[model samples]
Target chain A: MGDPGRDEPLAELADDLRRMVVETLCHAQAGHPGGSLSAAEILAALFFSVMRIDPRHPDWEARDRFILSKGHAAPVYYAALARRGFFPEEMLQTYDELDSLLQGHPDMRCPGVDMTSGSLGQGLSVGLGMALGLRLKAIDARVFVVLGDGELQEGQVWEAAMAAPKFGLDSLVAIIDDNQIQLMGDTATIMPVEPIAEKWLAFNWNVLEVDGHDPAAIVAACAAAQAVRGRPTVILAHTVKGKGVSFMENTHKWHSALVTEDLKEKALTELCVREVR
Target chain B: MVEMVAMRDAYGQALVDLGDRDARVVAVDADLASSSKMDLFAEAFPERFFQIGIAEANMTGIAAGLAVMGFIPFTSTFASFATCRAADQIRVSIAQPNLTVVIGGAYGGVLAGKTGKSHQAIEDMAIMRAMPNMTVLAPGDGVEVRKAVFAVADHDGPVYLRMSRDPSPVVFDDSCEFKIGRAVLVREGRDVTVITTGIMLGRAVEAAELLAARGISVHLLHVHTVKPLDVAAVAAAAEKTGLVVTAEEHNIIGGLGGAVAEALGEHRPTPMKRVGVADVYSESAPNDDLLQKYGLTAGHIAQAARSLMERRAAHAQP
Candidate 1:
């Protein structure tokens, strides 16, 4: 499909995003790298290709909004923002340090973070609010919320899902990163969320399915979400827990584990070699 | 005597006025719009009103999101649900970020005892006050509620407005100045200073008159803002009278009594007594009966004041 990531225009940006995530995690030595690695292509697609944002004016009222619902994946989010010029890329080295703007979770003080989010099952509802606010003010903009598959276990997510469609918030889009793994175990073993697309469809949402690692497919799904009207859209993005690094992929150990220097070097080499191939 | 009105009605009217004055002011409710008195604003600005059904946590997060977009969102629901059910949401979403959202907590205190313990919020103030960057307000009457709403709307950060369900005595007129973090001196005396907040202000006023008739003049202070308490006013009152009594419709453990005790214990350390619901669950009953059962009426406050003053006199003679 689309030359297996070679034809994707934002492929280089996605690769850079993954490298930054791994480096940031290795520097912090304490962060959730699995979800961050899994969400690289999605974050890259949104920040680099989909969102209509100006890095110079992070708080611009008219800019399209993006919220990291699965906020433990802050590494990927920070990488995309830094690459998009929301802040200096060099500042990525200070991630999770004392008094650093880059907190373990997404914070409003950061340059391009639309909403301060870390608690799961919260971003979709917040996005619904921003979408409603935009509609009331007559400001034309869309609100995007990225959710983790494991995060669906929280009941609040369903509450928001039941509300967005009722309000007819066509401008709100939720891209669920279905990594299928959680902190302690697999998502299905922890809490079965299969029939995920059917669940959203039952909630009256315009549902779409895509390969989360494919930036082109994710971009196309986002475009399809915009074409929808009178109902919110949700893209069920199938993904691997750790998409790039071979040892970390499909494993829950990397959900939040220390990244040793050796592992970091190995991970960087693998990511770099894939581009050349 | 002033006309009596429920504090919730004043809150509803304030929302309507705010909606008219500031287009950026929006309202969010959790299916209790009529009970929380947010229906007035909803009826006026139907477009700005967001009904989130019975989901308090989602409602709180939505309000936080709206605040992030530079909109002043007022989220309303029962005090018990708003503070307890969605406690974490308020802490992480609104307080940590310091957003400008006004949270209206209706049916506060044991006066809402008719709804049983599940609905009463005797610890709402304690929960809200413990949160950083939260401005807690328990306006004494309808007029104070109106003024406090307007004041908090103009305020730059998050606020929790605790209101009562039923109508109570009208304590102040439109001229009474209401400012956040400021305490109001209702009357002046050199005897025991009776400090009160929320619906207990009316009872405190009556208690002062009862003490005055018995040859003991009372200094009454209405502390509407529970957090960021007016320590200066409380200290001043205690210094003048040398005896203090704090009354409230909430649990004495962490409500107005607890707040006043903390203030005086750290600053003044004067002889004092707390008149409130003794740390116990309240039962559903008629308003006056429940108040009497919980030792929250005017007679109870006066008795507490008299006993504290007499105890001091006994020790003085010894």
Candidate 2:
């Protein structure tokens, strides 16, 4: 995993963190497990390896910004924020609960969240605006956006896609958590955004791709994206919905539902074993 | 008398002034700078202007994002697009979070004349008023429009500034100070009260003059800020004048007239008449012609006030 001294391997950390995702969902008794599980490594790479963010000072001016455009996958974001020390890890147990800091979707009131987002396809435009505003203020900070495959069907995403590179936001990086599944079914069947990389390329974005579940690949791909100049970058990550759990893998049933105590135990046991990517 | 001018022209000048005052204030347009009168702002600060090219939703979300970064963005376009087309985007991105994003609804109300009903936004005030954390405003003329623009910029949260494209008779002097939620008392009389908003203030003022000639005393209140409507001022007028006639260049429902009626209904319980477009779409005509056909002219307001006065007199006779 090319882990430098004084640390654990990236894949091991990502694989271990999958517990928090299911635990958050299980405690809440409702959430999107499919998308959250699929984007674990991607989020791990962003919060742990790639992004220059300080959890203690989540609102730090010089720190990087992260916007979860695909907000329904909030379980993963909440999990990552907790693990990264934005808040108490125990707070994950209160997710989706009334009066809890963790909301059903990503809300900026919670620490480490840049933009409050739930409605699809709007996050990219905001990221575009933030990038432009940052450039105007002479802030060299980077803005990272996480979008879902089905979320690409939103017209606002395309509107944002056209604008980012037009402004030449090389510091802006958009990672499409392309887990293949949408809310109802497969993304290709529902909307057909394939040749997605070419579409971004046509929009003049610097394009990259990686296995979304592979932590090291996710980190390396983001590094490559940041290296590009004079253009925004989009990393299309291929992943299976519900990647960790055996029966839930590539299935839409786990997109959102209760993770009963029985299923939670099985899922946690399955994710406990360290898997080399 | 104040110099007659268009609210749109005043808005452009206000932006230029605001550019000098607040560097955080940025303008985003959907490629209708000339119509929205944002060309002045663009000319003054080229680097600050963002031309989004007819994508209203994109403009709103972009502004919301900019607002998150401490820029007080003023997103401008026709009222129809600013309020209707990008409503969800505005609601989710700006309004819900209560960002310091100012929205300019240029060509607001039926004043978009000749461009027809599609461009007219009679329900803009209604739509914006419904959103939580949204400060909705409709300035009547050039002097007040400038004040309203500056007031909303200084305001803390999200605001929607409804601007008229039609040139109107200026009703306020340069010294007129604008407040966000307070009603400005333009004229005072004893018999009846004429409450109006947007371009209809000119007509209401004219109506007051006509009523005075006919031996009827007409009090006039110009309501520029619709949401956080100065209900206290409205209740005071309702208590004093007894008979109330509300006017606006918008639908009689859910706008200035509606807000006044609702306020008076709850507080003062005064007999009132609403003078505006009678719950219908506007047709293609000159601005004045449209105002005439929709019964939004001075004559219409005078007639409404007269009828209400006569009703009050008849009730008094008994």
**Candidate 2 CAPRI level:** medium
Per-residue lDDT of candidate 2, residues B70-92 (tens digit): 99899889998999999999898
All candidates' lDDT scores?
Answer: 0.91, 0.88
DockQ of each: 0.72, 0.80
Question: For residues B1-318, what per-residue lDDT tens digits would candidate 1 score against the true structure?
Answer: 757899999889988997899988999999999998899999999989999999999999999889988899999899999999999889888998899999899999986737899999888998999999999999999999999988987898899999999999999999999999999999999989999999999999999889899999999999999988999999999998999999998889887888899999999999888998888989899998998999999999999999999899899994
Interface RMSD for each predicted structure: 0.8, 0.7
**Which candidate leads in DockQ?**
2
Error of 1 at B191 (Å): 1.3
- Native-referenced Cα lDDT, model 2: 0.88
- The worst-scoring run of ten residues by lDDT in candidate 2 chain A lies at A1-10
Report the C-alpha lDDT of model 2 over A58-165, residue by residue, as the tens digit: 888777889999999998898888777788888998898898879999888898889989999999999989988898899889999999998999998998898887
lDDT of 2 at B19: 88
Off by over 4 Å in 1: A1-8
What TM-score, computed on C-alpha atoms, does each candidate reach?
0.97, 0.96
